[model samples]
Target chain A: MSSSEDSMCRAAVDEALQTVGGKWSYDVISRLYYGPQRFNQLRRALGGITVKSLTDALRQLERQGVVHREVIPTYPVNVEYSLTEKGRDFRAVLFQMRAWGEKWLPGEKDEKAEG
Target chain B: MSSSEDSMCRAAVDEALQTVGGKWSYDVISRLYYGPQRFNQLRRALGGITVKSLTDALRQLERQGVVHREVIPTYPVNVEYSLTEKGRDFRAVLFQMRAWGEKWLPGEKDEKAEG
Candidate 1:
């Protein structure tokens, strides 16, 4: 790529990283990728994540239009979190990265080999 | 995907993120993607990155087997860093993310819209 194109690519990647680059941001999105889940359910899904951090990550994703939060009022109030269309589309990036990780990263197989 | 598959995917992603998730790791790798560069050239390419942090990031990548470091014995000794085949394969992930960023991310066009 030309210098200009290279810079543009760099900027885009920078912005992309800014959006999903947090320690838990991409992982949180991956959890929601399966389907909508309650706040507590999401917390349960992502162990080792403090409630405050997960809340912040979800809110950040929501602000970026990558996640949607729905409130349901019943005898007991309910809130569900799911990916927006844009968020669903964002999965393509994660999917590619995950595939690359599986191939290059030391996974279960590697762990088994060493252990 | 099944529950077992989900966890596997998550592990893969977690490992992937660990490999490239640092604030400057991905950016550093991206700089090297164009071609091999001496330490200083890479430092120049990535503005605002501290020398120590870049060195640490490169060392981490080298440990992961993604980056190859070579020392040249010339009148002035020099060291060059290049991506191994595995590292080259990792670019596909960055390429996909870049494409997603340009589309969903607030880029030059978005900046112009605001300014």
Candidate 2:
């Protein structure tokens, strides 16, 4: 590829990677796709994730406009997160990825083994 | 979605995320897709990556069978990394992400401005 084309591809890919291909962003997006989930609820759904990691992930998604975060000014300040339209669009991509993974990278002997 | 379906989807999604949706793995993959690249070459291509982080990323891809590392039996023992066919399949995905980002998340005023 020409240097210019390559550079253009790199720029767009980098931006997209930073936006959605983040470490925990997809996981967080997957969790919120179902409905508006609260902070603790998201934390529990994404098991084994540290609080800081979850917070950072949420912040990144929020900044990208993929996540809708609503704060309920209640006794404890309940916060809920849901998917924006862009976020919902990723549902197809995520589902495709899930199918791809099961078909190609099924860690163990899925049903029948293949080399 | 049903609980069983959700669990299955989660499992497949998690496995896929671990496989290709890694932090710098796509960057590394993009660099290697053209041809075999040396470790230092990859570092420079993906500027600002720590040697340790690069090593860790490479190790992850190697473990998942996406990157194939070949050690050059030369005077200095140079090591080269390249992508497998399975890895090349993600080329389409990476390309799509680039297009998506250009349209949706272009950082600056992309060629034309949009709100």
Candidate 3:
């Protein structure tokens, strides 16, 4: 590849990584992939994520256009998060990642087998 | 899925991320994807990686079994880095990520078009 093409590839990879590189970003995204979720539901889904961290990750995902936030008009307003079209585009990538992890990594299943 | 399955999935994802979470880990892997590279060649290929950071990343990848370091016996011995089978398994994921970025992220190409 030409240097310019290489740089462009690098830039694209950089953008992709920025979306999911954080400690909780991918986990949050993974949960949202199941369907729309309320904040508490997301928090419950992702065990051990602090309220602040979850909020931060959601806001970041929202800004990146990978997530959509909706406010429901009810007795008490409820906010829900879901993947946008752009975000849903990541489903295949996430699936592949999970598949790779299971196939390649020394996972809990292997540990159980040895134990 | 069961909670045990969820945590196991999380653990696998964690391991995958551990291999490529850093600023330069993926880039380093990307470069090494083509073939084996000497340390200096790697340094040159990845623009602006500090020597210390490069060394640290290589050691980490080596420990994770994603990268193989080979010592060449010559008049002046040379060390080369290449992707192990485990590391090469990530090529598809990285390619998908690049495609996702190009399609979803407002990248340099889009900016250029807008400009």
DockQ of each: 0.62, 0.39, 0.67
For residue B79, give model 3's deviation from the true position in Å: 1.1
Q: Sort all candidates by TM-score, best to worst.
A: 3, 1, 2
**Which residue pairs clash in candidate 2?**
none
lDDT of 2 by residue, B66-89 (tens): 789999999989999998776676
Q: CAPRI band of model 1?
A: medium
State the TM-score of the second chain for every model: 0.80, 0.76, 0.87
Off by over 4 Å in 3: A107-115, B108-115
Top candidate, metric DockQ:
3
Best by the TM-score measure: 3
Q: Give one digit per residue, the lDDT tens place, for model 1 in B33-73.
A: 78999999998887778989999999988987788999999
Docking class of 3: medium
* Residue range B1-115, candidate 3, lDDT tens digits: 6777776677766777778777788879988988999999999988798899999999999998899999999969999999999899988777787788777767554786788
Tens digits of per-residue lDDT, candidate 3, A32-89, equal: 8789999999998777889999999999998888899999998799998999997898
Task: Sort all candidates by lDDT, best to worst.
Answer: 3, 1, 2
State the lDDT at B87 in candidate 1.
85
TM-scores of all candidate predictions against the true structure: 0.80, 0.66, 0.87
Point out where model 1 deviates above 4 Å.
A2-4, A47-50, A107-115, B2-4, B47-50, B107-115
